[model samples]
Target: MKKIITKELVPGMVLADAVLTPKSNILFEKGTILTQKDIAKLTFYSIDEVLVHDNEIGEIMTISSLPDGQITASERIKQTKEFQIFKADFEKCAEKFKNEISDLVAGNKEFDYKRLLAPIYELLQKGQTNSAVFEMLNNLRNYDDATYTHCINVALASNILAQWLRWSKEEIETATLSGLFHDIGKLAIPEDIITKPGKLTSSEYSIVKTHPQKGFDVLKNVTISIHVKNAALMHHERCDGTGYPGGLKAPQIDRYAKLVSITDVYDAMTSARYYRAPLCPFIAISMFEEDLQKYDTEMMLCFLENIVNTYMLNTVLLNTGEVGEIVFINRNYLSRPTIKIKNDYIDLSKCPGVYIQEIL
Candidate 1:
């Protein structure tokens, strides 16, 4: 059930719980199918919000197209009370985590790992599946949000991937924390370069690369899990030994760090920026498919397959200016799903130049 404002209520939404007057008299009973008059009565009494069955919310919002033929799953998820709560909680986590990082950098605070995990766990309590969570995160990825939002995104995505990989409960928690703290070194970098809107000069880029080691320096002194420390240091390391700081190969890199690396790149690449909108997940997955050698092969393939399938039945915008629904994921090319446009179907791999531009 989702608790949405009375203003957003529409006829045909079934109440999951009873609506009551201020003095607690029943105005409507549970399981009542709402009508336009019911909605007006709700607003007349100034009932702020009410719980509606999940399936009744916009008739499972993602499955129904709008009047103009737009079916944005992210937008649908945005209308849920779950998304509103998640967004507020996520912002709180980011702000708190950012302050904690500053405190860590100043050597004035003890790490509170459990406290940090609390919000993410509460978000999990909202009962959104992995794919639904992704849609919510995608919706929340606005340019004006705090930069610390990326850390939480990585943490959430890494947690989901860890769960998919069947990691132990302990390992999943560690992975989540590792993701949350992976980029702590960025705190030491100048805000100008971190927020720079243009391409970084070689010198600026070189300075930015120092964050890994800088992150390691702060973490090494803390009494945290070794996996988390390694995640901070080696998340950028590649399987092919081309990544920086240590240039460590797969075997030399920490396993947890390897897991975080995949999510790190996913969120970083898909996240909105000042110069460009966020890339579609399909585009990011395609990028990963093209560079599988750069990450842990097993994890990368697992992620690629897992993420690609999550978009099954999703409405998508093609680069050719047409919109379609993802009906199949090509096993050979995980990024190239078969799309259905009205009565026609196009296999993206067969149509070489076609690609998904956005999820709508």
Candidate 2:
């Protein structure tokens, strides 16, 4: 084993002993393989040195052990009767939501706010928490890039976040509605531009950017809550003032808009786009961490912390290919939690090159 300076350590070196935070908390356990992300965690915690073995795992092995069911965790979840029922409910509700959004945008009449929320209510009836909803959605997917699917996904996530915040039922309704129509303006954008598989031109992008205003314009005259209208207009507005339609900062942004902003980006990232596959939740977590400055930090931290907490006791696949069950979460690194593989527990925060590749 070698005691390597934290700054100089490279990926693939396995830990020789458990690394710890300055408070002496176990950070990374012995046998954890190094990853670039783990190294960054080291820097974040001000750790100077770690003990690692000299030899590498050699070509990086991925260990998948599902011999019992002969299927993946997600696949197993899908085979359940509950999931089938949920799938039917989800499809029926999404179609209903699509029609509701169309009617709302077309000014056909004052639509029932309760009707707009039926999709989320339907999905919520299946699971007790947002975590369970995420589990079902993450594994079951055929409409990754659908606008209606995106809206429903956002509403569901927003409701979860609001509940996590302990918001009132009325407040939750506003949040759910905010998410449901956050992109109603997109309906105004031609289907050709909205569904374009190729890179969008500058003009096309500008047209797309008008969505928030268009959404706000429709909601403005309607009898919806002001917060919902603001969310429609400002969901893309960043805390650091980098967003579009209006270059507003944290204080200038509406509270509900802030919540919707985070969920909007999260669902979008985890949903598949035409150009790329859906990102793993951990990947989305890491990206959130990287852009922490742009979001409402307090809410973002709460969002990340709770999202990671939902994975407790879940089996996960590590970047190094090891299969393990999540055992603990370090508040400092929501994307890198402790895992139990075989007979041992590995706190991923101490292992620089390792991370959750998939929530199996």
Off by over 4 Å in 1: 1-71, 145-147
Estimate candidate 2's alpha-carbon lDDT, on a 0 to 1 scale: 0.81
User: CA lDDT, every prediction?
Assistant: 0.80, 0.81
Alpha-carbon error at 38 in model 1, in Å?
51
User: lDDT winner among the candidates?
Assistant: 2
Of candidate 1, the 10-residue stretch with the lowest lDDT total is 57-66
Q: Please give, for residues 162-228, the per-residue lDDT of candidate 1 as tens digits.
A: 9889999998899998988898888888989988865577899899899988888888878789999
lDDT of 2 at 102: 83
- How far out, in Å, is residue 122 in model 1? 1.5
TM-score per candidate, chains pooled: 0.78, 0.80
